[model samples]
Target: MNILTEILLQAERTPNAAAIVQFGRGSGCSFDEEILCSYRTLVEQAQGLCTRILRRVAADAQVGVVMGNSAEWVLADLALMLAGCTQVPVPLAFSAPQAGWLLQNCAVVLTDASGAMRLQEWLETGLDLPRNTMHVVFGHYQQQSAAAPTSRAALSGPDRIVKVVHTSGTTFRPKGVRIRRDGLDALVSALWQRASKDDYRRYLSLVPFSLLIEQVTAIYLPLTSGGALLLPPADMLPLGSPGVIAADRLEIIRAARASALTLTPALVEALAAQAIRLAGRADALHALFGRPTAPLLAAGGAPVANQTLTTLDQLGIPVYQGYGLSENSSVATWNHRGANRIGTVGQPLPHVEVRVADDGELCLRSTSLFAGYSNDDPSSCIVDDDGWLHTGDLATRDSEGFVTITGRKKTLIITANGRNVSPEWLESAYRSVPGVLHVIVYGDDRQFLGGIFVVADRSRADEIRLAIADYARRHLSEIEHIHTPLLIEHSPDVMAQLFTVTGRPRRDAIAPFLSLQKDPSVHEHP
Candidate 1:
């Protein structure tokens, strides 16, 4: 079942209902200045765009999208799906060379005016593009005399590849994940089944459209449920800074009256800090959101600290964290409203089976499993003979079925005494310390664990170090305690090298930068 069918159905049944709302460029808090598209108009425009794209590309040919999250990007994605063309989405944050590398495998690339200009600049810098690759700017999509195809069945089968999402692999390089129509349909079904029955009137899109999680929850989930997708202006929520993103996101959620939101852990942490500042004033918090409260906030992409979750709960905004990967078509386990466990990423969704292997790896079998990697066969990379996708995450499932992720399989630290440790638990615990911004643990072959901490202020380094030392003494065993805490300078370059796009610490990428710290101290304070 093609997902576009749902959009068409909504158009036929409820033509006047809002399908998409594009917020205008302003202070990021203006709902009066907006462009609203009805269901009928959305379908007509998508069909019109589909008519133009079919003339340029063959069936099942790859179509690349090098644009940010906006109404134009949404239309292009739907047009490709309806036209039976596989979409290759490129995030705006990717470098010109990285964008070109993704475009090399595609038959056509679609972008807005700015994206086309960026590509032209890259070409002038001697970046090569495949000779057969076609470039189609969004505004130039002319309505041809030929009739547009309404359904995808005429061009491609449901089980065939429909989209290729590019994500960071274990090697820290970009890799393409292929997803099919049936897999996407299964994912939508699982999500709808897992979520509460309350109808979400407006859903906010916070992350980049290139991300698979955003593509599903932000776009597909809302579409299937007949909810309006509220997209902020391109300049309002830039991905450059976490602080800016959190501020803009809060403003838009209030202005748009969004009933649902999916966010990254970094964004959640930033918002938690803001919520703490607004704690005592109920009226001010109500005025900030415009309503008395906001909607359900679902977080993912990284481990959300217990402090962050508790702070959000105190603000009257519930947060449910989930665990998923690009290989599983976005979500495998989620803590929905019904069965939300505080610390664990909730039970497996419908039709998804999860188990822990003997070696502490999480294996998943789901109907929504990705087809395969773009350059490698499924069997070679993750999928095993029994059809389980071996997620490289170390996790444990409780008797009640909640899954707690410990760390990555490739990031386990082994001491000389042969004790293995996962740093994520310790990092999360350290985050509970006030003023602690980031922590990375390292002790591969050493006698004791040591770490680098990025704090809010250099003067408070001693305070944070002593707090962590006391925390380790109370909670951790002797073998797991981190004896040395090294304070480091926080800079943009340091963050870029140490963190992934979703704000998860990349242990291997951060290992080389750890040498910048000159001294490590064991706190004498209790």
Candidate 2:
């Protein structure tokens, strides 16, 4: 299937409807939902850009994309798919070393104005690609071309790698996950089957486009569902270093009136908190989402607390929890509107097959399974001979097919926005502090990183906290900054309770000690 062409066909059918809207960027009201592009504009711009790109980049050639969430980001995403180039998306949250690691594998890199500057800075480190390799693509949408646009590029086959999805997870070094067109198509199609056209009248994208899942939900899902994707305000990108949650997210939701959207568990909690404050209001749903009825909300990335899901449901927010991975091409199991099971990651999606292994590990077989890793070791491979991807997490399937993820077999903490965090890498940074003895970096399902530290010297606890703060500000990436830490004198009982016999931190044991209801941003750390 030609995904780009199909989307353009949708635009032609719904020519009068909104294809994309930028809130507060319009001319009229504060949240006027400035028509960034109508379906006609999308066909004109995307097709025109596709024609332009096909002439320069060869089909299946690795091309890198670096930018924040914006209209141009949308164009680059769609146009590259139309041109049949293998897109390599780079997150803005990535450090220079991480970005350089990815760029080394790409022949060409695309960037907006801000990304261009960062790419140029890499030259000083002698780690970036050549000057000509970087293409600044910030304002391509401003000049809509009237020239004849190519409808679609010649896609060779289903097995051909159409995209190289990158993940900065589990390892400090970056790695690419190969995605085939067939898998991508099948995954989206299966999800589209579960959605109605009107579900996402406006789907506000809250996460970075670098996330493959976001690209699927924010771009493809909206296209297939006949929904308009409401891009977040350019400066209001959440999951930025220092602050995982956008500073004014509640305010943005109050204004956008987005009909449906995906959120991390943390953001769900934040919205639930706000919804409680505005409880019983006549226009609460209207203020949060443009509709008076309950808006379709899907939560994933990390495990969403059942209590949190129940809270949103009581307030008319139908929060459907799901489980997914970049390997499975966004969503493997999802709880849709009609069928939802609390405390579980929902039933397996229509396209995916799930089974619990003899060892209780959740294994998945799907057309959407990632092709392969670009550089990681063969020994670290998750896929077995018969095609089932052995996910490191342990799980169980109920009689009704609801799968609950019990625990992980590996030491990886996936953040709420779906970013994978290697606590070991984080702990290494904390342990660098002289007074810091044992450092436990824990933020699974939690948006911002927080820590529990054991101090070498009891009197130096305050001093160690200050030093750790300095290290976080000067050394660590913004997103990796620990929100707060519990520095205490070491005790055998405390250590025993924090980690299981296998040495993994006991999340439940540590939960009561951590602060909730507030996660201070990077600025608030010091």
Candidate 3:
């Protein structure tokens, strides 16, 4: 059955149950916003959107979703599915040039309140589009007299492409991964099954819905399971807020009484710090959620440091790390909440097969894998003959089937002495040092390994450096020790360089900086 049916089924079972809670921005709405329509509201809204979209575009044509994390974003996604149109989620952080590339690639586009203003600005500036391309704003434009392009009679089956999500574009040019309905169904079902096992009740979403994984877990999974989604408060800062204190996130958890939350490594670190600041008075926070003192914290989007995990664990949070790329449709392998290993991403989820190549690269096969990349040849990303999605991440599996990600194969550093070092390992170790916010390890084609460290707490920089040095000396061999930690005062221009959202360092994009920093005159230390 189609994935959209899951929403329909949930609405039928518990129409009054809270479906979505959108926080931040100006408006806040609960599941009861349209009480009478209930679950039918989702179907009706999507149907309205679908009817409007299909009137101007082919059934299989791509429609871009450019918005932040909000209810409008979720509605647009469901509407696209019901309309049988391929949805493309454009990051709200995308620049005009980047947005233009996606717009040119897709046949049609949709923008929500958050993104509509910017898209209009770009469009009014005379952004060129294909002759037949169309762009529509979600709430702004309701009626059009244009002739219908294709009727529902010509619509393809559900197995056709449903959505397209672009990669973070850190290393290479951004590429779109095309997701099909069947794949989404499998993913949503697997997530619901897992949530059922864990008794996942309330979901609090902070990740932008533009992400495919966020779409599945934060939106679809909750709806499928007949659970509630608690959103952040309207005054809460965005994920990258300069003043985003732990209290900000704590308020959301308390307000939503959220039992489940998914966040990036950075947010995890921040939340851990907040927990510490609470000084063990977590009862108010815990009580607000109607959950035990411990909450299930699932972290993805980046590799979390062991120290951060250990800290959160000590603070009564169950931390689970998982690994997935846009190509695999969000999560191929995840650490179950109760069945977690300290440094591993846990085991492969149900119906997913994960194996390590002879070279230690992780390979996966799953029903949730994307159909292919858009605009380019499908084979360029997915080699259909192998039936395995090649995850560039290198990993090692234990006898118990737990997977520990070592590093990205493409980012592995080969020292001048021919020893292979996983920069991720070094960076993970560095984050254990207090006051260090971000660390990038580099020694490629160099005599020794070194790193660029960005410290959030500048006052403790000296102390952190000394502590890191002591830790490295105690735990690492001479080769693994960084000769010196270069402290960066300013954040890297990631967006300008097209590295990542949330300002995470892109190893590939920083390679040039690494090369320039390496001094050939320095001799290797034996």
lDDT of 1 by residue, 288-357 (tens): 4556766768877667777778778767767888888778888999997768887888899897999999
Q: lDDT by residue for model 3 over 120-149, one digit each (tens)?
A: 655664757433534443343332323222
| Clash counts for the predictions, in order | 0, 4, 1
TM-score of structure candidate 1? 0.75
Estimate every model's Cα lDDT from 0 to 1. Answer: 0.70, 0.73, 0.64
Model 1, residue 503: C-alpha shift (Å): 26
Please provide, for model 2 over 131-187, each residue's C-alpha lDDT reduced to its tens digit, 9 standing for 90 to 100: 445454533543234543334334334467878877655555666888878888889
Comparing 1 and 3 on TM-score, the stronger one: 1
Better of 2 and 3 by TM-score: 2
lDDT against true structure, model 3: 0.64
Using lDDT as the measure, the top candidate is 2
Pick by lDDT: 1 or 2, better one: 2
Model 2: which ten-residue window has the lowest total lDDT?
517-526
Error of 3 at 20 (Å): 2.1
Per-prediction TM-score, please?
A: 0.75, 0.87, 0.70
Error (Å) of candidate 1 at residue 131 is 6.6
